[model samples]
Target: MSNKHTTLRKPVLLTSLPLGVMSFLLPIYSKKLGMNAVEITGLFSILSLILIITRPIIGKFTDSFGRKPILIVSCILFAASYFIFSIATTSVLIYAARIFQGIATATMTISTYSIISDTTKENNFSKAFGRIHSYKSTGSLYGCIIASIILSFMTFTQGWKMLFLIFSILSIYSVIEVIKNIPESKKIVTVKCDINKNKSRNTMKLLIIVFMTCISSSILGPVFMIYMQDKFTNNILLLAYAFFPALISESLLSKRIGAFSDKCGYRYSMIFGILICAIISIITPSANSILILAILWILSTLGGVLYNVSEKNIYTDMIGESCVGVMYSIYSIVCDFGLMIGPLVGGILYDNVSHQAPFYLSGFFMVIVAILILILIKKDSICRVD
Candidate 1:
C-alpha cells in the first residue's frame, strides 16, 4: 500500500461507517415518515438535485482552498445532518436535512476522491479505488448488521432515530481523524495554477459516461423498496437478506476487478460491467420468488460496482491528480443530475405504468449508453500523469 492510503484509510473507514447504516435504512425511514412511492422517490431526487447544485461550487473551493479544510467542514455538517434526520417528522423537514446532507456529501466526495488521486501511485488508481470501496462495503455490511440488531430491539421508527443518533456520535471520530491525522493534499495549489497551461481533455467527453451510466443505474433505486415491500416487510433482517450477499461480493471482488482493469484496460471492463447490468435489470421482473429476486439483485449490484469503480479509474486516469476536485465535482454533477432526473421519471412511471416498467426502461437505457459511449471514448490514453 502507498503511504497516503495507509495514512487516510482509517479515517475514511470511520467516515464510511455512518453511510452504510443510512443506505439500507434511509428509504425505510422515508416511508415511516408517511412518504409514499412518489414522495420517497422525490426525496432521492431532491438529494441528488441539491448535490448537483453544490458539487461544482464545492469542487472549486476545494481545488482553490485545499482539500482537508473542506473535508473538515463537511464532516461537521455531516454530523449535524444526522441529528436532523433523528428529529425529522415531516417530508418538508426531511427535504431540508437532505439538502444540507447533500452539500456536505458533495464536498466530502470531491475532497476525498481528489486526495486519493493526489496520493496514490499513477498505475495503482484502479486498485486503490477498489480497495477503498471494499473497506466502505465492509463498513456498510457491518452497519447493516448493526441496524438489524437495533431494529430487532425496537420499533422501526424508534430504532431509526437511535441509529441516527449513534451515527452522529460516530462521526465525531471521523472529524478528529481529519483534524489530527489526515494530511492536506499537496497538489491543490499546483493544480490550481497549472490548469490554464494543461491541455488535458475536455470535461464534456468524460461527463457523458458519468451522466448516462448514473441515470441507468439509479432508475430503479427510488422505487426498489416499494417494489420489494410487496414480497417482504416488517423485519430489518429483510434489508440484510436483500443486501448482504451483494455487499459481500462487492467487497470481496472490488479489488480484483480494479486490478483486472489495470491489466486488461478500463474500456473492456466497463462494457462488460454495463452489459451484465443491462441483462440483470431486464430479468429482475421475472423473479417471482424473493430468493430468486435477491439473487438477481445481487448480480445487478456487481455490474454497477464494476462499472462505477472502472469509470472512476478511467476518469482519474484522464485527468491525473491535478484539478481532480474540479474534475470529480464535474463527474459528481453528472451523476447527481442523472440521479435527480431518473427518480422523477421513475416516480411518474411507477404510478402511471407498471412498477416493473421502469426497470426494463432502465436496462434498455444502459445497453444503448454502453454502445454509444464505447464509440465516443478513444482507445488512447487522453492524458498521462507520468
Candidate 2:
C-alpha cells in the first residue's frame, strides 16, 4: 500500500479500537451499574433508532459538504460521548449517553467507507475494504485483551470508565491524523437520484439484505455477556475468548475472502458464509464444555467475516462509486433497525423461551438470508455477474 493508503488506514484502526472495546464491555458494565435487562435493551434500541434516522441525512451531507468536516465534528462528538458514558451512573444517563454515542458513531464508519470507495478503483475496492476490516479486527483484539486485563484488577465500573477515558483520547488523536494525513479524493461523484435509476433499486435491495443479516446476527448481543457471566463465573475471560475468534477472522480471514470474492463472485461467498453461520448456531448452544464453545465461536466468526466482506462488496458493486455514501447510509439505517430490534426481541425470547432461543433464531434467519441472497443474485444476474 502507498502512503495515502497507510494514512487512511491508521485513523480507521484507531477509531475502531475504542469501538471494539466498548462493544463488549458496555453492556456487561450496564448490568454491573444495576440496570436490568429491560433498561439495557431500551438503551441499545434508542441508539439503533437514532442511527437508523440519522445515517441517510449524514450520508447526503457528506456528498455536498465533503467527508473531512463531517468526520472531524463526528469524532469529537464520538470521543465526548465516552466521557458522558464514563460519568453515567443511572439508567437515564446511560440512555442519553448511548443516544449521543449512536449519533457520533455513524459518521466514523460511513465516512471512512465512503472515503475508501472514493479513493480507490473498482478492482482495488475489495482489497481496500479487507485492509480496513483487518485493521478494525486488530483494534478489536487489542481492546479486548486490554479490557480483560483492566477488568481483572478493577471493578467493572472503574475499568469501564477508565477504558472510555483512554479510548476517548485515542479518538482525538485519530481526528488529528485524519486532518493531517488523509487527503480528500478529488473525484466527486454526484448522485442523480431518479425513480428509474437502476442504482436506486439496487441500493434498496442491498439495504434489505443488510437489515435481515444484522437482525439475525445481533440477537446474541445483549444476553451473551449475561449468559457467560452466569455460566463461567468469570465473565471477562469468556467475553475476551468469545471475541478472539472475531479478531482473527477480521484480521486474517476477511482479507483473503475478500480477495477471493473478487475472482469467484460475492454472491456465492455470501451464501456460503450464511450457511456456515446457520449451522454453527444450530449446534453451538448445546456445547457441554468450554472447548466446544470456543470452537463454535471461532466457526461463527469465520462465517461472519466471510459474509461481511462479500456483502460489502456487493453493495459497492451495485451502487457504484458516486453513490457510495448514500448507499452505505441506507445500508446503515436498515442494519441499525435490525440491531435495535435484535436485543429487545432476544431479551424477550430468552425470558419467555430459553437462553438458547436467540442462537436458534439467529441461525434460522441466517438460512433465510442465504435463500434471499440467492433470489437476489438470480433476479439481478447480469449486474452481479459483471
Candidate 3:
C-alpha cells in the first residue's frame, strides 16, 4: 500500500464528518425551516448550477496552480459556508451558504480525488476509492448518531444549526490536516489551460453512464424523509435511525466490493450491483413497515457500495492520473446535473403524484441506466481489465 493511501484517510475522515452530518440533516432541517420539497430541490439545483459553472474552472486552476493550495482554499471556504449555515435566518441566506458550499464542494471534490489519483498506483485505485468511501460512510454513520443526540436535547432547527457549527469546527481542522499531513503531488505543465486535452471516446460514454446512475440514485433525495414520514413516523430520531443501516453497509462492504471488482472485472461488479439496487428501488416503495424498509434499503446500500467502488475505479482509470482535476470536473458536472435535476423532478412527482411515484420513476431510470451499461458491455467499451 502506498504511504499516501494511509495518509489520505486522515483528510477524508476529517472532511467527511461535516459532510456526513450535513447530508443526513439538510433535508430534515430545511423542512424545519418551512421549506417545501420543491424549494429544497431548487436549493440543490441552484447549488449544482454553481458547481457546474465553477468546478471546471477550479479543476483547471488546480491542475495548473497545484492541488494543495486549491485544496486548502476549499477547506477554508467550506468552513465559512458552515458558519453561514449556522446563522442562516432566512431561506435566502441558506441559498447564499449553498452557493459558497457548492464552490467549496467543487474545488474539494476535484482536488481531493485528483490527489488520490496522483498518490495511489493505478492498480490499487479501486481499493483506494473504496477505503476512502468507507471512511466517509463510517463518519456519516457517527454523524447521524451525533445529530440524533443533539435533536434529543434541542429543537429541530437548533439541533441542525448545532450540527452546522460542529461542521465548521471540523472543517477548520481539515484545513490543518491538508497543510500538515498531505504532501504535494506532481507539478504538471502549468500552461496548458485548454482543459480539453483529457476528453476521449470512452470518457464521454462513462460520463453518460455516471449521469444516469447519479440521477436514479439521487431521485429520492428531496422526498425520502417525507416518504418515511408518511409511512413510518415523523420523528427525526427515527429518520436518523433509518440512515444507520445504509451507512453501516457502506462502511463494511465497500473494501470487499472493491476487491470483488478487482477479481471479477469492474463491468460484472457494477452491473450486478446496479441491477440489485434497481430492483430494490422498486421494492422499497412497497415497504409498509420499518423492518421491511430497513431490510430493503440495507440491501440497496450494499449494492450502492458495490457499484460506487467499481464506478470510481473505472472512471479514474479511464481518465488517467494527470488529468484528474479536469476530467473529474466534467464528471462532477454531470453528476451534479443528475443530482440536481433528479430531486426537482422527484419533488414535483412526489407533490403532484403519489409519494411512491418518485421511487417508481427513480427505479425506472436505474433500469434504463442498467440497460445502457449492458449495451456498453456488449460493445466492450464500458468494461475494462487491469
Q: In order, what lDDT does every prediction score?
A: 0.75, 0.74, 0.78
The Cα error of candidate 2 at residue 283, in Å, is 1.0
Strongest candidate by lDDT: 3
Candidate 1, pairs of clashing residues: none
Model 2 weakest 10-residue run by lDDT: 377-386
Q: Give the TM-score of candidate 3.
A: 0.89
Error of 2 at 313 (Å): 0.9
What's model 1's TM-score? 0.88
lDDT at 286 for candidate 2?
76
lDDT of 3 at 116: 74
TM-scores of the models, in the order given: 0.88, 0.88, 0.89
Lowest lDDT sum, 10 consecutive residues, model 3, at 377-386
Q: Model 2: how large is the Cα RMSD against the reference?
A: 3.3
